[model samples]
Target: MPAGEVQTDSIVRDALNCGKQVFIPYIYGASKKGTTNTNIKSMMEMVKLNSLADYESLQRDRWGIPAIDPNTFDQREHVLQTSLEKGEGLDIIFVPGVAFQIDPNSKLVKRLGHGKGYYDSFLHRYQTKFHSTGQQTSQLKVPPLYGLSLKEQYLSTDDEMEVPLETHDYLLQGLAIGDGTFHNSTS
Candidate 1:
């Protein structure tokens, strides 16, 4: 789903209820290709800040208080690390992007995010952490990562572009549509 229509409140509530620490990648501007900064601020408020005023104060004055930036590797790493620490490890990540697809073989989902490769970098780091801890096999039980999308943007099998195999493997999930439609390669 477009970040604007993701129903962040609902997703956050669900994750919190399930004892999942939610890490949402917030986008910066009109790119409209990832979770917008506004949405991220809103989510922080809903989950940690407790109020708009609290969020504003933190953003306005907090030095080194991680902010989202798709192009900077250092910034991305810092944000991921900070979120992981706050949540005790990212159990669920709400990614934002323009398009996504499911790969039947790898059972992975691919999201067409912005040009920066922030998502890819974050995923790589996360997987590395999982692997280094020798929990890769056990952690693999996490279901296919679901790519949120809007109804009108759904692509059919006949779509011209083939999602790269590497991208598919990175996600190893499925796609979720805004109108309650869920598509999976296995399905």
Candidate 2:
């Protein structure tokens, strides 16, 4: 992983070692109908990683992040599929971002991504698909989003810097700082 990005190999190892189900983002170009949509050229879904060995065997992308092979896309189990069939969604998501900040007034976490909108889109899709199936929100839970970032990625709260966010942006529930500190937003 690059210095700019938080290393997640240890997280993956720990989760796997604990016998937790682990999923990784798989980005591709497809529409809601499951057809190639080269026009927009971006859609993301979390695909299950069977084991730490599976993660270790994956190839890294240009950003030096491990990416699943396209040939195995059809064979892998999607997080959405599990949510839909088993009625169990993720417990938490460790979000990655270019920058993050806490809104002073609202006490909510805000994340700035790499401009791809992949994470936002996937979360929105998950909420819509999983929760809209005529089930109680309690029965079908939406996972709390927690950002993972280095200390440098957090904007200076001392200086009162504001993070510019749009309506479509999803606010994070908490933050896991690389320096071994955690920040949870009251909102």
Candidate 3:
């Protein structure tokens, strides 16, 4: 809420205006040790924005990211965990990246993060856990990871950002970059 320049528009406002649930990242642990956890679904609480003031009323942490109060959301529903339940799973995730390298054939966007592997860790574990139970039944839809960046940060097939990737690193290629969305990464 400080300045929308980094993100441009209030995606939260638009989503909430349409009666959609908005989940911001609930980050924990220490990033200095390379172990930051973002429970974007379970830990993250949905905001019920009655107006623009509701969005403005949200608080920000030291990192300047908007946060929601857990006490405000309903305790009965676990949106992230329930993604794999009822024959539906995480449909879409707006993965943040400093830059991206798209695989030629797969077109999946590998995130060049801010030297921290938090998203990679969470995505890897989420996919593995979701697959363990949902794979056999053909009921789970692993959320397609996407990213948006300024056109200046866009990397062509030739450019390499040299972001190191580990075995646990998730290669998320599907992205709804800017105004484009496609189905190729997850099913």
Best by TM-score: 2
Residue range 1-187, candidate 2, lDDT tens digits: 4779789989899999999989999987676436555666768899999888998899999889999998898788898776556766787888899888987767778899988889998899888877676544675577889999898888856756667799899999888888887888853
TM-score of each: 0.55, 0.90, 0.65
User: What C-alpha lDDT does candidate 2 achieve relative to the native structure?
Assistant: 0.83
- Residue 42 of candidate 1: its Cα lDDT? 23
lDDT per residue (tens digit) for residues 1-187 in model 1: 2233344556655655666544444433433334555533221211232233322333311323333333432333333344334433444455555666665456566666644566666566565655555443443432245677776555555688765544323563567788888766566
Backbone N/Cα/C clashes per model: 8, 0, 3
- List residue ranges in candidate 2 displaced over 4 A: 31-39, 135-139
The digit string of per-residue lDDT tens for model 3 on 1-187 reads 2332137236767776777654555544344224345533222222234455656776876657765554554432344355444445555666666766666666666667654566765676666767776553444567667675555555767775544455766667465445343434554
lDDT of 3: 0.55
Ranking by TM-score: 2, 3, 1
Q: What is the lDDT of residue 97 in candidate 2?
A: 92
TM-score, predicted candidate 2 vs. hidden true structure: 0.90
Candidate 3 root-mean-square deviation in Å: 6.0
Whole-model lDDT values for every prediction? 0.49, 0.83, 0.55
